[model samples]
Target: MKNLLVILFSQALVNNFMLARILGTCPFIGVSQQVETATGMSLAVVFVMTMASAISWLVQHLILNPLNMGYLQTVAFILVIAALVQLIEMLLKKNSPGLYKALGIYLPLITTNCAVLGVAIVNIGAGYSFVESAVSGAAGGLGWGLAIIVFAAIRERQQLAPIPKAMQGFPLALVTTGLLAMAFLGFSGFNVAKFVGM
Candidate 1:
């Protein structure tokens, strides 16, 4: 339990895919104009990333490694993540039309989100077990969700704040994101692995 919690905390905060590694910025910026939409996207990401990581781990250990087809890791992971994104898309459209409409093209863009693929690859590289991969994936998604929601909330408020015209839109967002990244960088000194007994 402690190990799992440490992994969750480290992945979700210390090494966030969005604020720390800077992956999946497109969807982060596009769908983060509102908290509600960001929440929906985050939930979808959580599902896709978790399932992709678990399935990809199985594929690597059981199929690819066994058949000496390790060269196809990227392609195999892409297929798995793409399939998961498609499933999420259909389910969202069926159950939450409003959110589906709000997410718009960004929902489909999740298929190409590097963060999803990165998590799978990282899990393999780290030699994490199946459960750890799943947890890392979920934590990565949650980290992304946390960043996007916070960014969106700030942008929403910034629209009402008095600011120079030059730094009003994307510029302000860029600066804010940079600062957010800097803040996350502070976690790099925390020695998460040591804390987790790894």
Candidate 2:
């Protein structure tokens, strides 16, 4: 219980996917122009990240590590994530048409999102158990969701503000993200290694 809490808090805030790790900056900037789109993207990412983490951990520990195939980690994890994204897209479309309409487009895009890969790689790098990996992955997804939502809100408001032609779209969004990253750095001391009894 304590370790799970540590993983949740550390990944969500101290090691946030966008502000701290800088993963998934593509969607974080691109799809965040509108709140609704950003929300959809976030939901897809949350599902993908959690599922990817769990599957990757299983593959790594139960299959690759024991077989002396650790070098294949990257390739295997990427394939798993892609498959999971596709499965989720199909499931959502079948079970919930409304959610499918809302988040379907983002599903294919998330297959390439670095944040998903980052979480899986980070889990292996940290040598986390299956439970820790799942907790951290979910927390990371939540953090990514929080980041995109905040960015969307900021961008929506910025749309009304006067801006220079040179710094109009992506440049301005990047600058905003930079500031958010700077603020997030303040929480870095909440290190997971220490907090999670590593």
TM-score per candidate, chains pooled: 0.95, 0.89
lDDT of 1 by residue, 128-171 (tens): 99999999999999998899989889888888899999887788
Best by lDDT: 1
lDDT at 146 for candidate 1? 91
lDDT of 2 by residue, 97-130 (tens): 7766755455687889999999999999998899
Among all candidates shown, the one with the greatest TM-score: 1
Q: Local error of candidate 1 at 115, Å?
A: 0.5
Worst 10 residues of 1 by lDDT: 189-198
